[model samples]
Target: MVNNSRTNPSSDTISYLELLQEILNKKNNLLGFAGVGLVLGLLIVFTTPKEYQSSSFILLEPEGNVNSFGQMGTLAGLAGINISQLPTSQMALTSDIFPDVIHSRDFLIEISKEEFEFESKSGQIQTLGDYYFKQRPGNIVKKTINYIISIPGIVSGWFAKSDPLPSILAKSDEDQSDYLKLTSQELIAIGELKKRILLEQKGKLVHLNVEMPEPLIAAKVNTMVLERLIDYVTAYKVGRQQRNVEFIEQRVKETEQKFNEAQMRLASFRDSNQGLISQSARTREEQLQFEFN
Candidate 1:
């Protein structure tokens, strides 16, 4: 009779057993890989610098008007003025704009010059940007990683025939200016500052968080950011009022000059026609006086 079985069950079972045995034989190699992975994970955990994070919660409400000017509203309208637009107006910067203000290049650059009391290094006061760079290279592993990353750049720099750029010095608070242009180093520092600082708003409250190597410095920076934000918003609110006041003052000066000119013309007309008197002229003079007054 022809064979009914296509394959031998005994041979197939033996082959499956042999496969499992091969895997078991290489068990030491698998264990070695797992051991190396465990060591690498531990190295990363211990070698990484510890970050001190501090968060500040700010509750923002609508900017209220001190004087509603309800009583003066009618008079102000008659004089072609709006009392609501005086002294203080609605904030031009809404909550949405706050993030832009916080992340602004100029804002970051200006804040970078601010001094902070770093408790890590014997309570030394250092510029924010300088302190950030100082905190780097905390461990040997990180230093080695940084060195490795810069190897290519260093090698290329050696072969380049260009003159070396002078190192950028950190600017003191007094040395900083509103119109100051950033150098390459300053730009890099500003970039790092942006990364360290984070702003988030949940519901009606805003959370400003800053991460640093020192808790004291982180807290100080958080407070400083809050203060600066308040100051900036205040300035923005008052700045518009100041500009409007200046424009009004200029208009008042012009009006006063015109009034003086009219007075001068009336005096000259009276002087020239001293003796001339008529009922119609008297009426006309009365009308002119009323208009000038």
Candidate 2:
């Protein structure tokens, strides 16, 4: 039998020197690519609007802390109002559901409808929804890319008259529903908004962040968002407390009915045994007394 073996030891492996030489050989191409990349990066940086961020957060008291309302009581004393003796809300917004309150569509929609002074519009005040629709916030590259990508849809839209989606709030009917139907502009505004705003919770404190093209606008929007969050939290807590009060009242009614039944049973036993003297009557009276007690 004959054996034949073939092998290449340095097959596809490059030495350190050879790799350096190869890179040197393509010096011009690398430099050209680097220059093009730098140019593109610079263009992106220049075309993008500088955003300013404003941040705020609320420090909540410890859960189920009865002493947390001390400050409220103090304030009430100043106003000659005795809320200290009044009932306080037993329910609170928990950390688990806190994020939902911040990111909810209804919460965001309220913020979008708020009017703010725009520097880009020469001090003319406009709602966030309208501004987003009219001034489409994005860098030039994004707008160009979007325009190119949407060419087919835009062309089709030209041939076919398209109607805008209806807003739930804009409806003139007396009917109201739990679900929301956002208009095209509101949807666009919300999309832009979700990008500019952020919310995070650490322990009991919840932080809110808002970013905008202008400094004043960022601060204003941040304040508004915080205010809305506080209002929503207060309303939620109040509603929960009201429900708790109702539950307690129901329990109280049931207890009263049981007490009345016990009293009636005891009274009937005494009346029926008035003329009878028997061990059974004594035993029955004792049983009824035990139950009443």
* Candidate 2 regions with alpha-carbon error over 4 angstroms: 1-32, 65-92, 159-176
| Cand. 2 Cα-lDDT | 0.76
Candidate 1: regions farther than 4 A off: 1-29, 64-76, 81-91, 123-125, 137-145, 163-179, 247-293
Q: What is the TM-score of each candidate against the true structure?
A: 0.65, 0.73
- C-alpha RMSD for every candidate: 7.2, 8.4
- Residue-wise C-alpha lDDT for candidate 2, range 1-293, written one tens digit per residue: 99997765575355766888999999999999999988877878888878899999779766444344455445444434444344553344665666677667887788889888887779998888888888787777788898899899978888996566467645743365765988888888888888888888877777888998789989999998788777877787767655544544555566567768988999998997798889999999999888676
Winning model by TM-score = 2
The numbered model that scores best in lDDT is: 2
Model 2 clash pairs are none
